[model samples]
Target chain A: MKPILRIGSGAGFSGDRLEPAVALAEHGALDYLVLECLAERTIALAQLRRVADPAAGFDPLLVRRLRPLLPFIKARGLRLVTNMGAANPLAAARRVVELARELGTPVRVAAVTGDEVLELLDPAQPTLETGQPLAHYPQLVSANAYLGVEALLPALASDAQVIISGRVADPSLFLAPVVHHFGWSLDDHERLGQGTVMGHLLECAGQLTGGYYADPGVKDVPGLAWLGFPWADVDAEGGMELGKIPASGGIISLATVKEQLLYEVTDPAAYVTPDVVADFCGVRLRATGPDRVRVEGGRGSPRSSTLKVSVGYRAGFVGEGEMSYGGHNCVARGRLAGEIVRERLAGEFAQLQVDLLGVSSLHGEERGAQSRPYEVRLRVAGRAEDAARAARVGEEVEALYTNGPAGGGGARKSVVEQVGIVSCLLPRDRVRTGVEMFGP
Target chain B: MKHKLFHLAHSRAGDKGDTSILSLIAYRPEDYPRLCAQVSAQAVKALLAGLVQGEVRRFELPDLEALLFVCEHALATGVTTSLRLDAHGKSLSSALLEMEIEMDRDIDTRIPTHAHAHTPTQGS
Candidate 1:
């Protein structure tokens, strides 16, 4: 049995930087490199693109992301796993095969499917969030179950060098390889839970390495510009030490780890994922050395019987416009401009939101007594059923230069179709996962 | 004396649907109890009265010296659906740190007073 296995995170989210990931593949000496690129809304957006073109649903940067790292992967015999496939793993796997051939570094690839369960969805079912019947929303676009380690095990068992998937839980992307390499039983919840702790810590790439911890005077993290991605060395028992490349920029301290440990996580005792009900309350982090921390003591219970399925629907369109005003009473001019747009779009939009940026934007209308700023940006946004009506909100804001506010400049407007996501539980037995292998 | 939580603690905000999860971690282990006592869910909900529309639940991790605040109806909505510029509510952590709390005079010396500390050298 391999005493220890090293896994490195390549990309935290879809738009994460490429250089940090490249740094990992070239120097990190990793056994497996997992790139977690899917977010809650990414797959739903990809589904919309798939409807327009069957092969266009994968991550748009898949090729660019893989082009530079394929050589390192091939040379090092390093296994790669990612959810960059988004809505189309098969096409993404095919692109990997083609890219490998073009680079003269042929590699076996596996595409894991079965996360898409739109056909099994019943519109009459109730959403977990609102308890409203699915049929209540007429514009349903996609339904994808969050698959677990079970979905990727078959691919890992195969000789494929790269595994592409859609909608696999983020932690499962890292935990699957640990379970595979350690030969741990699926029922071994303790190890699975501890393995998940490592996954969760490393999942956000730079976040673990102090990308998000810098607060100038309070919590300063150096070398953020060249912030390095993180990697963890895990033993058979799930004990691990997390670190980044020595030459890379970023700090890995107990403070950084503790912050990420609870990020996006609500309950400390029962952090639910597809594979296991991870209990991070018992987890511990120690600063072993500079840019290195040892993590242990995470516990887990049996897996949940149901899988979370993200259902996406067309909510509506958001129309927004921004115009900046400077020099003498800009906050007043900005507020006046916002009032002008609100008046013009009265009764036309379902929701109208107005803000004088730099004055009272982020926290809503709760500005305490403070000195008035010399400049402010007026922002007017509204939601409507159709694009034309939404566009009118921005048109009114843009008209401020010629129609209402004086000295208005840098006017900007955007109208985008919003995708709404709701979650519901599906019976675990309902998901039938399979893997298709391809080679160059 | 009343001191801003920013002096003794640091926080990170996360979102799930309309709920925003903020992790408040004490810089020193000795300050955990003070954080638990002062940074109650009610206090957090009241501090973010304008943003959080629903209940605020606080989960404590004594082992980690941290407090997790889950604020419902906090994002205006979720990231994709919310019209707010900072839809993810990433800045809420900083906002929460702005909250003031009564701190003991003796404990004030424990907090870092410098504006910057040199990045620790390797193997320090």
Candidate 2:
């Protein structure tokens, strides 16, 4: 087993910043960098784009996120991993090849695929929570089974400078390198679980570092504007010390670690991923130093018989509009403005949400003991089956400028068709995952 | 005197579908016992009375001095479809801070910090 594996988090989501990732590559002296960019809805949106243009559907910002860091990647041999392939892995892998050639950077790249189980998805499959069949949905847009590290190992084995994948489990992107380098048994539940927990912690990118940890005076984060991404110094035993780059501007305290450890975890005892069932309840953590935490003791059991799949279907459209009102008793005017729009769209939409932004959106029904605000924004949003019908809500809200509220300003509106989702379990035996390599 | 969870703990919220999950971590290791006693699933359910349409399930992580509260059907719909302003129910973590938990009888301050001194939590 290798002594230590240093992995840097490049980007957390599809739209995460590249600067912190570049900083990590240049100065952090990282062995591997994992950028988890895919989300549940992201794949569905990408699938829609792929339908429109066969050449598109991959992350549009993939090149921009990668081009600047090619030098660090080439010179330092920094093996980078990201699921920025979105819905199109091959195309995305090719983009990296084209970009590398353009910049005279020689790096082996690979894309892991077979996540798209759209064709195999049967409407007869029962949903996990609701138990209803997929037939209940009107339109089925895209379906992908969340893959694990088994697909990523081959690509890592190829000694690639960068690895791109579509729809692999977020944690698996980071876990693949550890498994590849250490030659750890995939069946070793405890160690896999240990590494998986680290993946989950770093998967949110800047979240562990401090981007989302801030709450102003209550939970203040300094240098937040220049927030750095988190990286880990992991051992072959799967234990690691989590820290951020110098001047990364985030606390890696017991609280921050604990918060991230439990984030999105419904059950502390059974945090399920494709590779292992991690039991985070027994996990231990302590403040190792400034911007660092020594995290260990993550336990695990055998993998689940079935994998969770995110099935996206074409849900209708959302119509939204917002207008601000200023100067004296603005709440009344904002309320009136929303009421006017509500009356116009009555019975035409499924539901209309009218919010006096400063009052309802932030304060809820309770204003506490605070005095009334000088300004409020009238916001109305609703859903419909078609674009024209959905567009009516926003159009009516805009119409209220001349038709109702006297001093309404900054009126904005939008209509968007949505990709909705249903969750189902797929049998483990059904999926076949593999990696394809490209570039010099 | 009664103390809210915020006085002894800090929380972060995340969402999947209609459910909103908040992880509440005690500021000090000594405060874990208080959290175990006071932050019951029933109490969280009651605190989110009208806001949460479904039940609240609490999962313990004593190793981390944390409790994960999963509030089901908390969002009107999922984030993608929900017309709610916050979309992901990001504000609900602060909303949970308002919940009144039983304070120790010896404690005098209205918003008492935990027994442990503050570790430098600020990042710069």
Q: Which numbered prediction scores highest in DockQ against the true structure?
A: 1
* Error at B112, model 2, angstroms: 11
TM-score of 1: 0.96
Chain B TM-scores per candidate, in order, are 0.85, 0.83
Give stretches of model 1 more than 4 Å off: A368-371, B106-124
Cα TM-score per model? 0.96, 0.95
Error of 1 at A344 (Å): 1.1
Using lDDT as the measure, the top candidate is 1
- Tens-place lDDT per residue, model 1, A105-196, is 99999999999998998888999877899999789898999999999999999999999999999999999999999889999999999999
Clash list (residue pairs), candidate 1:
none
Sliding window of 10 residues with minimal summed lDDT for model 1 chain A: A363-372
Instruction: State the lDDT of candidate 2 residue by residue for A262-291, as single tens digits.
Output: 888877788899999998877777665677
Q: What is the lDDT of residue A228 in candidate 1?
A: 96
